[model samples]
Target: MSPTPQERRAARHQFGTGSDTPAARRGPSGGRKKPITVDAIVDTAFGIVEREGYEALTMRRVANALETGPSSLYAHVVNKEDLDELLIGRLCAEIDLPEPDPACWRQQIVSVCTQLRDQYLRYPGISQAAFAAAPSSVDTLRVGEGLLAILIAGGIEPQPAAWAVDSLSLYVNAYSLEVSLANRRISGSDDNWVVSRGELLRRFAALPETFPHTKRHAAELTAGTVRDRFDFTIGLLIDGLPGARRQP
Candidate 1:
């Protein structure tokens, strides 16, 4: 007789097939298995990224996880680049963008940045995927539209608001990637990073003849947590905004 549902589930689990669902597919043996869908492809891709860093994410890997061939994925995701754009869209589209609040533009901007950062942080190396993606996706456009509305409502000129959004988005993505890379490379021991950071600062300070500015503010420069530094930078960006043209 055929294997019971429980036995089939055990077989799927024993293989590399993911969660028990209709999406599960059987091998050449002709049994109940999940059908591959775009959603399933995306889910499998994320799982691979989480288990192994982004570098290990490939079509074959995801396909293998689904008990299917990589060609099966092509019907959904065209290639690695296409998959990346979809991945970014998948994450970005979920952000709950706030309606433009002229009176609270600054706060809104901060909240948006924080949300985007947290979203990307969940995937560890998602920034790499973001870097490779185009801005054509629905999700990416939504984010841009939301930020633009907020900036425009703040009495900012169109051009500078556009520039600000571009620059600010770039900074947040770049900063998130930098932090993610550091976390992956550093040991769990905080002492190592602390000592290494201090040593680098001291080295700069000792170079007074060659780097006067470095020597002058080493202590001050080293005085903040990562969040403090990020907040200070965000504050600077905010203060410089409301960049409308002055009346001649």
Candidate 2:
């Protein structure tokens, strides 16, 4: 006769050893065996980063969460870098790029950058993977390809179109990563976190005769909302684009 569901689970537990018996193999408080898969491991890794931050993510922790040996994780993923890449690829899958529009290519590029920032912000540990991911995976490349097509449609020359995709992606990734890192440093506390007006007052008080010019414009240094800063940077780059003056 075929093994019962309980027997099958026991054998799976036995495959790794130690916790092989039905009683030992019982789930947390004898609940149930959590199913395992590549996605399961990835999801668990995401949870680890979410709860403890990216620095705490490790194969051992993931194994502990799933009640399995770390060796089992290697059968599906190669190494920490590979797991990080997989996580980033999964995160990139969330962004939805607009179709190339010649009439509004500039706006389309900025819109895609905004979406990219939103995705990274939503997934806390994502920017860590992005640090070394310049070439990008299939999902990221699709967005780049779409942006390139949009630039080409706007009459940008082929060489500039190619460079623009890389340059714009770099700008967005670097800027967003910087902001995400800063936000992470602020304790997730409403009361303890720095208030804008108070922050300005502190800066104003710190300036002295040694830094007269800095004191004068301290308020301007930390003035705008993040959206305002993002718009300013993107606007500066758009204004400098070679094809900016081309007829639509």
Candidate 3:
């Protein structure tokens, strides 16, 4: 069944994609005030993105959510890119990085990366917004700066610490996106959506012999919690950063 408008609204909330504000009126003329804030529009845009994927996100849908016209939305938001930047900024605000600890910089990096992953999962469509942009907003830069400070404090040189911040952000964003997309596909499908690890292995077994490595390690591939996957990727990334120092 297609989701009802209320269901869609709730889904938006679950995804942390947008917020719905009470409508306001101007003067004695209760016809229509400029009925949208940049926050509201972006929040509604996020709702649209969560309901429909990024490719389907549109100003028209966002306006519909806010019960306003697209033209009004354009007054606050320029285009998809502008809206995306706003959404990314909103997502960045959710993360609160702690002080860089020189003694446990590796653990600190892992924690920051985990927080980024959790935030993206909480706000499903955010990765699509943050994908292309470098960290520019205060929150985004603050996270980057903390990561860099931790890495440098752990004895990494300046350039490599900077590079690690960029590299780490890219990995966290990209991997979380991949996981989110896969999850949506699984959850939204009606046919046999809840596959067990063994069932997944059976399905893999049915595939062609060309994917030899996949077949060989099918058990290991599907062998753990999403938390496990997150931790594994984080461990691998953190383990590799020390090597980045050699590149001068």
Candidate 4:
């Protein structure tokens, strides 16, 4: 049986497969399975990513999940790079671009970045794909367009606005990738290598006399939650934009 429209929408959000096309359904040994489509391939790939992280996503793995040979996936997805583009495209599609609000452009851009960060965090290590994927994908361009519009509306010149969009995107991808790596380290069996903030502070405090500043500001160095750091970095980027309107 094919998935209903509601099911497809749910899958798009949950698995980051933004296609409206229905996914293939597996059948019993005697019965025939539904025909596989591009949507089905992406859905299967995302399933693997959700369960085992992006590093586990492979053409053969997706083919196996869809009960087909690796060659079959090539018919729809040309290669791993193509598949990565599709995955990132799906994520970009999920981001809701707010109409340009000149008064709150900075907030709008930050909100979009946060949305993307949350999506990347959902499938750990997936942001790595975003860094590699081509920027030409339609969905990816849509996000760029929206962000550019927001920045321009906020009084930024076209040249700087375009560069700002790139900078913001790079930051989001890098930030999400770092978070995913940290989470993986903490969850892995070798988690003893992952240092706690308090331990870090203690280490800093124990530094040699040459590092007086580090010893004196150990607590400050180890301060703030992940969200706090994310917010602070984004705020710095947005606020540093030339001619950005300061909030009263």
Candidate 5:
């Protein structure tokens, strides 16, 4: 059965709020085993993600990390989907949203995106969960609400502001996922397929006449640090917003 609104609220309060549930005074095995709470589950999941990447995260893996069984995880988390939402919610809760300043709204949005990017990159492919997580997660909604407030304060109409938030979120997720995949490829043993910028340039330059423009503009294509490209793309998105104020 689906959880009621009140049940959902209680669950969010129990899991999403960062507070840990109390450990039992004793264990069933007559040994001192740490209680398995939502916090412990999330912490264990993050450890798995950090050490082995998000692809390695699973109920069984988290259970093993907690020295418990997968069935034990169901007591706190609903399933893999629920756990994904919790992970994203936890990351969103870490974002520090600023007060809306019309003169600085653009920079504020950029800062939010940068914060989310850093968070996603930290877990390496965990943004995949963000893509699938339900939008109703309270912590995720908090970040969206913060972004909407900033955009509206900057003179954006309600509809465009809402859509802008979605676009910005999609871009951040896609960008972070790409970077994570690239990093994984570069770090793997069969990384010969992942070439340095110089090698990329050489490949572009070596292409036949069929790719004239790509060959001619190889340097420009390969230019800029990842951050430079990140800032550039975000700037483009922010500047394109109707009625976006440009500060001197």
Candidate 6:
């Protein structure tokens, strides 16, 4: 069965994805009002991104959505950077916390990475914040901690495990950012994606004549869907980890 709306809201709060607004905000009529809150501000920011696209998300846009001035938002939100970090934390928290299974660390890593990508993609342009402020958030640190523990349990040294977490998280964040931008440009999945993809391929195939190799195997270069590419990249990292395992 589908979750009740209230249940979903509860989950968001638990995951830091939604705010507990202090009651409904009153319209300009002033009969009743929900005080503008940090959570509400973040929620409004997400709504603006969903409607106008991620690039259009800003404190002013959120203020406009909430029917308040941008300065009012400052009362709840420090600035755009702070808002981005909160967004990142919310996205990261949405991922299922991985269990450190000694025998299945590789699978755990892949599972964690895939879940993270799915959640981060829900908020386009937000994962880019991962590069700047994610480490400071509890959610991001939780993911890193789980992965590091699993790495150590699997016979990997502390230093290598640390680097792996850094490298793996970066890879997922960068890949999601690229895909989010591409999705915006494609304007939803349909003929537009096909046409845009075809155009990209055509450019590559056309250049193969000059570059030789590019023309020879353009199809191979663009063979996979986003999911396929993500899985393959993740597989490479997991499969290669043993080579870097520390000597006892």
* Top-scoring candidate (lDDT): 5
The residue-by-residue lDDT of candidate 2 on 107-133, one tens digit each, is 887787788877766656467776756
lDDT of 4 by residue, 191-232 (tens): 677899988987897889999998998888889998899999
Reference-based TM-score of each model:
0.80, 0.75, 0.74, 0.87, 0.90, 0.78
Candidate 1's C-alpha runs over 4 A off are 1-26, 188-195, 242-248
Native-to-model Cα distance after best TM-score fit, residue 43 in candidate 4, in Å: 0.9
Cα error, candidate 1, residue 210 (Å): 2.0
Q: What lDDT does the true structure give each of the candidates?
A: 0.72, 0.68, 0.70, 0.82, 0.84, 0.71
**Superposition TM-score, candidate 4 onto the true structure:** 0.87
Per-residue accuracy of model 5 over 131-248 as CA lDDT, tens digit each: 8455786799899999999999888889999999998999999999999988998899866867899999989988999999999999999999888999999988888889877777
Task: State how far residue 101 of model 1 sits from its true place (Å).
Answer: 0.9
Q: How many residue pairs clash in each candidate?
A: 6, 0, 1, 0, 0, 6
- Show model 2 residue runs off by greater than 4 Å: 1-35, 134-136, 188-197, 245-248
Which should have the higher lDDT, number 1 or number 2? Answer: 1
Candidates 1 and 3, the one with greater TM-score = 1
Tens digits of lDDT, candidate 6, 43-158 = 88777766766788878788777776776666545578777777776677677866676677777788888888887788786677677454755666677888888787777778
lDDT of 1 by residue, 168-202 (tens): 78878888888777776674556555356678787
- lDDT comparing candidate 2 with the true structure: 0.68
Question: What is the model-wide C-alpha lDDT for candidate 6?
Answer: 0.71
* Model 3 Cα RMSD, 1 decimal: 9.3
- Model 3 TM-score, all chains together: 0.74
lDDT of 1 at 200: 72
* Full candidate order by TM-score, most accurate first: 5, 4, 1, 6, 2, 3
Model 5: CA > 4 A from native: 1-10, 13-31
